[model samples]
Target: MNLEDLRAVRSRERSSDSLQDLRASFYEEVADYIQERKDARERAAAEADDPFSSEEVQTLTDEIETAEQVAEAIYERRMGKLVKQASLAAAGMTGDTDGLTNEERRLYEDLVARIEENKSHVLDVLAGEVEPGAEATGDDDAEPDPIDAAHANPEPGELSEPADDAVAPPDSARDESSAAAAMGGGLDGAEEPAAVDDAAVSTSRASDEEGDEAGAERTTVRITRDVGDVLGVDERQYSLEAEDVVVLPEENAKPLVEKDAAEEL
Candidate 1:
């Protein structure tokens, strides 16, 4: 072979070898990097407050590896196509032929752009980032709640039971009050006997129910009303997500929404 032909052959051979090495080395490097990440994740889990056991780690790692492999496959295919095109162009452009036809120039530019784009995607995937425009979707076929689906109830469900008041006296106070009212009105108070009797019955019933639930068994937490008043309106307006707060107080210091009549105009 002539000097130019020998040079061309050597160049093609080197390109082929380089491409082969890249193909193998890419996966090996990616595998090692992924393994290192897995090891780090396992160590983190072990040190976490709620540690993942070996079995849990194994399961999660399996899932993660499987997903990563799928992503790598897509990256590999895209990269392989681009590399093949680039290698073919390199092989064709053997001599120092800088001056080219319009079609050839366009093809070379397109090939270069494709190579760059695909190579970047492969590197991104290997580095544990997702490819552009790839989205994962799942089934959205679950049935809705009957009450919610119906929309019959405009309001949310019944309010949870209120927390007990700490400063307020127990059921005994109501009992004393009832006794005093009964004694004060017993045939010697204002209005007719029937009206007096009805009022006493109503009061007694209310006192009995209140006594049943409002005994010393109730536990209460207290906060100052003025402290609640000092809270910014913006803070009051924002609702907390379940994950945002460590613990929700049994009783809210302020009502969820202030009533127009409840607040002074």
Candidate 2:
């Protein structure tokens, strides 16, 4: 397909119902194209006394061969999708029926039944025991586990000091030192640990109260631009678009309002 035609097909692929309708029409068109190619091949054969020697015959044959190749590609794509759906259904996942109609449901069930009849090979294909086609768009490299990576790679503020002696006096030592300085005499080494504990308890209580306030307070903002996209929030892109109203935590809402990208709603 030409770029524009492929773009149009991709645009239509967003909704499931559209795909269900488009599949039949697309298959019919492919079948017709294949039939036309076969007719052309026969005509090409007749037009050349030596079909293999004639450039025109060779070109016609190539086009005819291309049509069949394209048809097979389309067929395999449909098969992959059907197999995925059937496997997911067998595994009890039925999410995202936004565009699936009753007819589509029946077709899915029929495919599932056929798959079950040859369950061994079908299961192998689904389980990646068999590579059905090498036409997948995604990188073959497996993605890293996000939760594991996050735990392994903590944020900058979360990084621990090598020791209390490193990076100046950390909060623990500073709080104790400040408390001693405020007392107009340095603390005894024995009392310094107690001073640190007291400071830690105070800090913990303050953080808990602050967290409670932030959690309890929600703010509504009218977005001037798509903050959802900027923040990489999935499925809620529309909610964070320009001129859209969204509710967020007060802590999150304050900066956007200050920047004039959003206003309180």
Candidate 3:
């Protein structure tokens, strides 16, 4: 619980990949020890005629800071081991839990439970036992509409069939009807070419407008460092490297530019 004790624990944690056994009240003791040093430092400052000249207060202050750093280092190292242990346990490869304090044990259990739950759901989806984002219809036996059924499962050759109620025209009448139809078709076809041209122009203009809108939302930047793969705010994946020039959504580009990892172009 003293400064030397804190340093020794930190050294042991750094030397060993596995967590070292410690008392269940180890962190509580460390906190109490730091608080005691702070109180002592304050008392020494008040008692000394010249607080700035007091060596005892200075020593206590230094010890408090060092103890805090050492405690934090030990905690980070143990936490890393606990996270790895939790992952292994979730995968059915349980590790030693004897070294965990009550709080850490609870955290470990929670992590394992979450990992297992996620894995189970993902595996069920992969196995096709569950559908992704699918909702239950609650009526499995409900019949499909006739119109929808016909469209989904059309009969072969049905589209090519003619209506049954039809009459044949006389030969002379048919010849006159064909002549009149040909003359009307010639007149309509002349306007059809112009209509087709207008449609092409309209489609091209729409595509250009879409391109301009997309350009406005994104920014051009040059990568100064290798950012292997990043997920953008726009939900697009970008693979970038040093010296690569690319366009990214403004939100995603801003962070990189501020970090000096990229320059806005």
Candidate 4:
């Protein structure tokens, strides 16, 4: 199709209901027109007694190629405009919404959904960073520690189930205030030793988990046919096809795997 013809088709199909149909029809026309040219060439060659004539067809493949090129160029221009409009909507640009038609809104929502779907990778999934899901899991699964977990329900200065080897102190010698202050607290108060131990252990485990998440090496994966486009990983890009491998964090690859788009290496 010529430039004017393509524009005519697009203008007529700009409505939401006809947009998909328009794309399908454009591709079909390009394919059919190219095939028609080839068929005409073969027929013309056969008509001549000497099929291999020195005369070349002035429009040999040019019209078909041009048609294809024009179609793609139109698609790219439209796609660029739509992407910009969608971005402006996402950024909450006022007055930019003036001309957003129903068709454009649909396209805008789709683009927004795609960005949200990949948000984990865009923000948190990266080299030396923990999985985005991990952070979510950490938040969801974490339980608040009880204030009296260490020593529950104890009387003031009363030793917790006196140790086996402990000797009984003279009643007068065991002043409750001095003893409670010494142990940092009695049954009624938090045990300093127990609280300290718990805090230290919790801190240590948190540090270890942070280290594991940060030091985790990149994993490799292969894209299956389900992933019909090329994707960018941390430092490279991988085409979407079977047997194509890419290295990335598990969080970044989760959607692909869930979609049957890739398998872990």
lDDT values, one for every candidate = 0.37, 0.49, 0.67, 0.47
Off by over 4 Å in 4: 1-24, 49-58, 88-110, 119-265
Ranking by lDDT: 3, 2, 4, 1
Q: Is candidate 3 or candidate 4 better by lDDT?
A: 3
Highest lDDT among the candidates is held by which one?
3
lDDT of 2: 0.49
lDDT of 4 by residue, 102-208 (tens): 55556667876565545544466665466545533324466645644434545688555545767878764454333223222111111121112444445545644
Worst 10 residues of 2 by lDDT: 186-195
Question: In model 2, where do residues sit more than 4 Å from their true spots?
Answer: 1-21, 95-107, 113-265
Where does candidate 2 clash, by residue pair? 17-99
Per-model TM-score on C-alpha atoms: 0.19, 0.31, 0.50, 0.31
- Over the stretch 42-144, how does candidate 3's per-residue lDDT look in tens digits? 9999999988889998898878876775676577667778888999999999677877777788898898988887787787778898889753333459888
**How much is the lDDT of residue 246 in candidate 1?**
12
| Per-residue C-alpha lDDT of model 1 across residues 25-125, encoded as one tens digit per residue | 33444456566757767786786666555566666576455435333332332333344556565445432224332433455567665655666666666
lDDT of 2 by residue, 135-253 (tens): 33223586767976775787877864344555665765665444323222111111011112444445545644664675555555556532322221111212233454555545455
The CA lDDT at 210 in model 2 is 63
